[model samples]
Target: MTVGVEEEFVLVDPRSGVTAAEAPRVLELLKDERGVVAEFLRYQVESVTGICRSLSEVRADLTRLRGRVAEAAQDAGCVALATGVAPFARVSPVTDDPRYRRLADRFPRLIGEAGTCGCHVHVGVPSRAVGVRVLARLRPWLATVLAISANSPYVDGLDSGWASARYPLWSRWPTVRPPSAWHGTAGYDAAVDGAIRGGKAIDARSVHFHARLSPLHPTVEVRIADVCLDVDDAVLLAGLVRGLVGTALAEERRGVPLPHVPDVLVERSLRAAARHGLGGPGVDVLTGVPVAHERLAEDLLVHVRPALRATGDLEDVRSGLWALTARGGGSERQRALRAGAGTPADFVARLAATTRGGDLERKAAQ
Candidate 1:
């Protein structure tokens, strides 16, 4: 299956460690660049990769696009940061778009704090009906995915004691939640229609389920992960999500029954994953019992092992998970930097360096 990735980033002034409202300038510089676009917040920009079939292709595309955005940020007098929420709060004005303006007017407080960024993965499916089936299969494992990709630990310059504080902030939206067990395309369409009719959402785009059929593409979009600090982690997420989808598709073909898990239990697991990431306690979706985060992650790997091997991503995903365990997720890394750097300025400087391809640059230099 072909996969595509969309990553959002925050623009900040490296010296002051505060967000910068320079995305318009950055977007102008990247006008000639394909798949680079503005986000709802003026201080954020997004990079999208065209359909890719391999992890290597995902890496190459992200590396090149990240490099381009970093260079443009320099030209725009800002630095691009791959983070879920700005370490310090400074809400940028909404982008000059009518839709965003309407959203701001309709929900001032929610949109004001909606500066968070996330990584979205789109995996191609044959049809909406098949996509709905894949979404059902994906529901139980979404928490594990969130845990693995947790990158937001700070809110308003303070440690929130959650691996991904962005989850709660983003969940403030009325329609944002874990998707329910949908029967088919008809059921999915009904839910979307209901959300709009009931005024819970402005439109289909506003139906922000964790996983859904992409309104603009023939794929299943998994919208659970925080925007990763490292390009490798982003690639790892893409590989694992694609594997999960592949496994689901195989099961569908074989007429395997869908696993039964309560939505409330799944939602609880998501919250636990957000609070602890991979280093603390989490709820297992299958058993609905408390389990170590590491164990949940292992279960995900085991569940998708066949698909990973089939797609030749087994080794890369395994090694990537090992690296995460050794070095930690973005939350752990951010906390370590905060403790060692001694100042917010130093912390943001180091963060900006990483977001701007410092590690990739070092590898190339060596």
Candidate 2:
């Protein structure tokens, strides 16, 4: 199976690290560029990678795409953060476009409150039937995916006391949550059609679940991750998402039934992930049993091992896991920075450097 990645970055001033509503300037420079687009908020920009057959290709695409974005930001007197949220982005101006204007007009409060960057991985599936089955089986494992991708611990200049504040901050929206198992393609389509009748969702793109059958592509979209810091972390997430999809497709092929996990328990597990990430306690999705994050992560990797091996990504995934564990996931590192730095500037400056090209330049700057 091939994988594609979409990363959303927040634009910030290079000096003070405040959100900069300068996407117009950046987008203008990238007017002829492929794989780059403006997001809902002007302070946000998204970059996409083409369908790739290997982790090497994903890494190459990310490197090239991020380099271009960093150059554009530099030219525009801004810096692009691969991080999930910034202290000042929630109040940043909405993009000046018909769709964004319509949304702001319709959901005034939400428009004012909403703004977060995320990483989405799309893995190919054979058909809608396969995709639906995959989605059904994918729900239980979704929270752990989010926990591994937890990078949003700060917002409005405060540590939100959660490993992933993005979880709760995003819950304010009416439609966002982990998906429920559906009977089949028809059931999934019917639920989506029913949702749009109320006008909360104006189009197919509004089918916002933690994981969903992509309306515009032949892939299952995993939308549970914060934009990762280390490029390897991003690649690791893409690999895991593909593994999850591939594993589910295998289960569908075997005619194994999706497990019947209770909705309340699923929600509880999700909250646990948001609270502890891989640093403390986590609730098991299928069993509703409490366990350490390490155990949960182990179970996750074990569950998807076959798919990883099938794709020849087992080594890359394993190495990435080791690196993330050793260096710390973004949430843990961000918290440590705040704890140690005498000022946010020191952290933001280093964060800006890391977003450009990871540790080499960041360390050189220091």
Candidate 3:
């Protein structure tokens, strides 16, 4: 199976939360690279890797890609951040592009102020039927993943009181929501057709479920994670996703029926995850009872261990999750920095310090 990742990063002014339209300039510098591209907004750029089938290869590719992009952005007098939302962004700061402009015009209220960064993992599936099955099985687990990886804590100059404000804000779009449980390909196709015919989305391709069958690729796209600041974190996330997809496929082959989770319960779990992150308690999708985040993560890891071992990624996943627990999520680190500095500028400067390329570190020391 082939594994790929796409990360949307924000180009921020080092001192202010203002968006920078520097992706074109940065892309020019990285155009010679293997897997870097511009995102929908000028302030955001995406980095994808060539097909990777192992953890080490994925790690190397992601590390190199991030280093290159960080170098380019620094040269342009801007710094990039991997967060769900910038703490001080103003909605008016989004660049004036045709697509953005159209979105703003059409959904004046929602689109005018919805710039958020996220990471997406795409793992190839053999067929649409497998993709649908993967989506069905993965739906209940989405909020668990989100809770463990909730890195967005602030937005638009205020504390959003949610670990991932991006999830809630982005979910406001009429067409975007957690996918409904589908029995099979027929049910999946019917759902897509309804969404398109009702004018809720542009086409079958635009169904923005938390996890979905990628219309443009022969993969299942996991779209629930916030952009992680550390390349190691991102790589680990990619590994976990690959393992999960592999596990789902195995279950299908074993004739295991996908678990059923009610839509309301899914929404509630998502909210609980966003609000508490892994810091406090969250609702358990399986039990419908509240439980500590750490316990839930441990349970999840056990369930997916076979897939992890099969891919030779169990160690990476275990180590990465351990590191996160120790260092805390990006939101926790950002909060600590903010408390110490007492200003957003200082917080951003600290972020820039952490995001600076390792290659640049050597040059700067001279």
Output the number of the lDDT-best candidate: 1
Which ranges of candidate 2 are over 4 A from the true structure?
Answer: 359-361
Candidate 3: worst-modelled 10 consecutive residues by lDDT: 357-366
Residue 300 in model 2: shift from native, Å? 0.9
Clashing pairs in 3: none
Q: Scored by CA lDDT, what does every candidate get?
A: 0.88, 0.83, 0.78
Q: What is the C-alpha lDDT profile of model 1 across 255-313, one tens digit per residue?
A: 99988989889989999999999888999888888999888888888989999999899
Q: Which ten contiguous residues of candidate 2 have the minimum total lDDT?
A: 357-366
lDDT by residue for model 2 (128-154), tens: 888988988888888788788888888
* Candidate 1: residue 305 lDDT (0-100): 94
Clashes of 3: 0
TM-score for each candidate, following the candidate numbering = 0.97, 0.96, 0.92
